[model samples]
Target: MEIAPGIYSMTQRKGAYVHAFLLDDGDGLTLVDTLYDTDAHRVLAELDQIGKSVSDIKHIVMTHCHRSHLGGLALLKERSGAPVYAHQWEADLIAGERKQQPVAWRPYAPVRVWPLQIALNLGVARHPPATVDHFVQEGDQVGPLRVVACPGHSPGHLSFWWEQRRLLIAGDAICTWPSLMLGWRGFTLNPTQHRASVRRLAEFDSQILCVGHGEPLASDAAQAIRAALPSLDR
Candidate 1:
């Protein structure tokens, strides 16, 4: 999905399913989030479909430090030698300065427990231990993308915004999947912070929302977020 002229959403096929975005900045590509190791080959395949090779990726901006989001970083970095950018807080966790925690809003059903844990242990549900090359604060500019600090899901969680196109690449700040109404379960540092971040994002007049899960929204993204707010409490 095209969040703007050069941005494209690259969804990974996983049990929970995750998405990453690609930004073709006229010169090269900037990847927003790299899927898990299990999905690394798929990400490479997708890149091939777009006429890009792994080596063509110049930079990678991580939305947060989650296994599903940063699992393939080591492999991708080895292939492309691209620099990884992340918020300072997340950078700490990714770099082993802090211990990673589980998400808070997991579904109550018992069916997913063991399998989820297995995936986590196998490095398919969380990021493989690694380091970031660049630590970003709230207002950092990544090529043409602007980093919007949206912490709540994690201390350093962030979203990317393209002011020129009114596009927002919301990582897990908001998910499009209705099944994850309460927000992504398994590991969330703070629910209250996450909600506040969502509200903050709603204030932005973005025309497109390319979230981490579910379908992408075109135009009136703020309205869609408003409509989803009520269900978040369910």
Candidate 2:
């Protein structure tokens, strides 16, 4: 689905409605996160729907190293020959050089995500590993996005801003599924960092909010984020 003028949203039912974005800036395509299918059939189908092909994708960027988001990365990179970008802290994990640091074993609220928490704690259901071609930091541009380092869910978790479109691709720093919250409580590695990061995200004048999980918020996005801020302290 084209959520914005040139941004396409692709979602997979598994992995907590894991969502990805495909951007067309009239300069080929840039993919943000690949849903939970290792084969990448869904992403490929989206490209087809948009009347594009894998060759049209010029950059493959990652928000973090979580399995739900990295599933199609390896296959997409090989087929498109697109350079993959991510934060340095997450590079080794993406490359399979190291395991992702686990989260707490104790379950948190919104019970639907408990299974995922268990899976992560056990290091089960790993994604196909792929090498990152470059490491991006805050203020760096990846295609049409301005990288915003949002660490909390993970040390290197990231979000992106498209100033021209007033769009915020907020990764897992915020979720709208099963009710909006700071993030999945059990999966957050550092609540202090996450809280601070979300505060920063809320500062943007985002008209459209695309998250790692759940449908995109097309209007009043910035206000919605602001409304959720107080909950972080609860």
Candidate 3:
């Protein structure tokens, strides 16, 4: 789905479904997050749907360091030769400085049964660490998008917000699902920090909320976030 004029959300299936945004900056396309390695072909196929090729992806921006988010980095780098951009703190994880942690979920979570969930957590033990071509801090600009630091899911988690366009690419800062569901079931490095990140996002006036795991919220996104604030406090 085209979220804006040149921005598109490529929804892909892994353990659970996930969405990665594609932004065309006229020079080349910028991929928000790379899908899982196993789903690379599917992702490439989806890119084809928009008349884009893997080689057309000039920059790979990671929202965080989760394997599900960076699993396809090696393959994408092999194909696109694009510089991978990530937060300085996450650069080590992305570059193999720190070991990628195992994915663990509460036994009562909804997606444990899915084979990909186990595979992603256990099967892919190590991610191919790559160097960051560009390290971004909060308030930096990537093309026309502004970088916003919202670290809670990971120490270096970041989101891209296009203030002029009222577009926000929130990387798991907040999800369409309930906070408890995400805390107990979804992937999070730190729940306390995540809550803070959510609160920080509320301060920004955004028209769209593009999360890593659900459909994009196009209407009253800021209000929706305000309503979800109480849940985070609990």
Model 2 per-residue lDDT tens digits across residues 181-233: 77888889999999999999999999999999889999999999999899999
Candidate 1 Cα outliers beyond 4 Å, as residue runs = 1-4, 96-98, 105-127, 179-182, 232-234
Among these predictions, the greatest lDDT belongs to: 2
Instruction: Quantify all predictions' global Cα lDDT against the true fold.
Output: 0.73, 0.93, 0.73
lDDT of 3 by residue, 1-234 (tens): 787678787665553456688888788888898765644665687688889889888888888877667767778877889988889888888877876554554443445434544564664556676778899988887766788998767788899987776878887676553221223334556778877777888877988878877677876778877776786655
Per-residue lDDT tens digits of candidate 1, residues 97-172?
6656644333542334336544554543345566789999788998768999988778888898988878888888
Model 1 alpha-carbon miss at residue 83, Å:
0.6
Against the true structure, candidate 1 has what lDDT? 0.73
Model 2 quality (TM-score):
0.98
Which ten-residue region of model 3 has the weakest summed lDDT?
Answer: 177-186
Q: Please state the error at residue 6 of candidate 1 in Å.
A: 2.2
